[model samples]
Target: MSWIRSWKRLGLFALLGLVLSWAISCGSGTPPSTTGQQPSGKQEVEFWTMQLQPQFTDYFNQLIATFEKENPTLKVRWVDVPWADMERKILTAVSAKTAPDVVNLNPNFASQLAERNAWLNLDEKVTPEVRQLYLPNIWQANTLDGKSFGLPWYLTTRIAIYNTDLLKQAGVSKPPATYAELAQAAKQIKAKTGKYAFFVTFVPEDSGEVLESFVQMGVQLVNAEGKAAFNTPQGKAAFQYWVDLYKNGLLPKEALTEGHRYAIDLYQRGDTAILASGAEFLNTIATNAPTIAKVSASAPQITGETGKKNVAVMDLVIPKDTDVPDAALKFALFVTNDANQLSFAKAANVLPSTVKALQDSYFQTAPVNATPVEKARIVSAKQMQSAEVLIPAMKNMKQLQKSIYDNLQAAMLGQKTVDQAIADAAQEWDSRQ
Candidate 1:
């Protein structure tokens, strides 16, 4: 579900409309009209989601049908938006007061609108008993400034996918479980097999894995006051760690500009020994690179000494100005309830944010005849017990990424010392705050 953040589906016909729609959508954005109501007097609420069309269309249509059957007076209009266009579409839609009643978005983008009070404050809307339905940490992700703006939906956590052949070539019996072990294996794999141990982009705007790594390494991103906190001794060490990795040629050169896709390419091409990504990728590798898939095995994500892991959450947010706030919350809760979440998690190959849904036997235990993908699912689901959104959702999150990454790159290229890079990145963030 979180992959939609980086996934772009086909379209330029839509791209042309993007610029125009962006402007109009932001112009006092219009909320869905009441005009769509049928003669039966059922109130209609619109739901918007990132690119999940075609593949999940049938699933959702049935879900909506089922919901409507239960709530006879409420009708839902499902809008499936392309992934790349979400930001512009939402911005335009929200500003015009025409935003959907309930929308699916990640905290990274949703936080921006939340700061403007564009989304309803769920703390007041949902009862305390209702709040107890979700995993505490997952629910915590939707809160900003002590107010909840959304309810957690689907989740994703990465697991280590390693090539056994490559490990054998490097004389390593097991894939590394910690960053320290990963660093050592990187060198051994490089020397023995002439392959990188893994691929993680250094590109400022790409995957947030590297940034999450810093936190896993015990570097606080921002302090209690919400100012930059990554300039401490721990932060300097984290910066230097990446610098050394790049300078020593352990990371691929393309990492400087490439994104997670490139990491997948390298892993599939057998140029990297491991791929840290969603468990669903095991099925992908099995199809794309059967040879590699045959020898691949799943392990826990490479963590720092702290053993922290990162989780990606897709949330359900209701616009503050929506005409059907109560209806929206009810539908959202229905969509995310344990039964619905379990069904979607199974259909979508993602983890569920609902506590009971996650405790289902499907997630808790792999069958005796489980395939690699099945076992990986358990590994991913298990991480939910500890994984969380490492980067705190905030306004201008991309700016924070850019600052730290640009500085870190400079240090790697010998343009700045590690200390200077960390200091500069911290100052830039504080200035913005």
Candidate 2:
């Protein structure tokens, strides 16, 4: 059975590699290098980004134009890749020595890339003044082992998105503040409205999103020694908490396979009364399903186990072998600067990663939509200072994350008791090492 599983995993990865290779072969050409002594005249830099389409195109273009006007001799060529294909494409480009001058990446992936020595250290490029402009926590996320490889582009944090109409029907006067209150409220919402209390998509291979919250609840997935520790007392309790919620029918069984989009859809259709997601969901709800926009965003209730709130950050980084390191750094700073940060915040509803941008008039006094962006912005900003960083085990995080979540899914589905599932996960983690 183990051998069969290994073969299946290898096959899946092989298929992904083939698909990535095919995509890279069709691209226009290799991304140009902008480093190694500035060109005598025009220095053209290639900037690659993930699908920042219709909403962010104008703002990004404007920022580029302004930067070019100021720099005069430097020119930037922007290439956009869809998010679905981003990881595969970027890795292929890097391996083929055809990578972009600069690239934007999520913080979670940034750390992994840095571990492989794939990103350039930006410590020397950023001046004290430039560093001061960004939020302290945002800057910290971009640094790994004393090297700064990326800049914080935009920030996001999860919040409790509740259906106001459903709450009213349930006779709940307000959102819950404690985990106990939240569970009770969920039960009440379901009894009165015949809808699930909360929607969370938990899958074995895709557990990072939900695991982030569990970590915030004081469940340590890894110990200080960087060893897998999710089978500990804290971790077991956190797993049991979710399992109980599932057994009580307060959560949907589909959560085992659902993704963020699916949960958002359930919230929009009023099939679920609460969702734990980022601010982007507000824009999505408003645009895709207007009725759901009527819901309100509030701070997520604390876990009874730990009173601390959890926020996960997505960071942007520059790869080490980037051809135009200077140009890449400049562009990274430009995009994350105060002016452009506000533009991105307004258009994408993402919290700005810079302190000044977050304090700007647009974010400070932005008008309330039915699902006010302010709620998320305020909560994220307040929590940013103390938010826990996402630090999975560096050595075998991919395997460890998969093992922990596979057992978690089993517990959630009643296939195994929480203790049994956790014990199994620990055994798997040890064997893999």
Which residues of candidate 2, in runs, are more than 4 Å off?
Answer: 1-40, 295-314, 366-371, 374-380, 391-396
Candidate 1 per-residue lDDT over residues 221-293, each given as its tens digit: 8888889989998899899888999999999988898887788789898999999877777777888999989
- Residue-pair clashes per candidate, as listed? 14, 7
lDDT of 2 at 349: 58
lDDT of 2 by residue, 29-67 (tens): 454445434556767677776655544568778888999
TM-score of predicted structure 2: 0.84
lDDT of 2: 0.66
lDDT of 1: 0.82
Model 2: worst 10 consecutive residues (lDDT sum):
1-10
lDDT scores in order: 0.82, 0.66
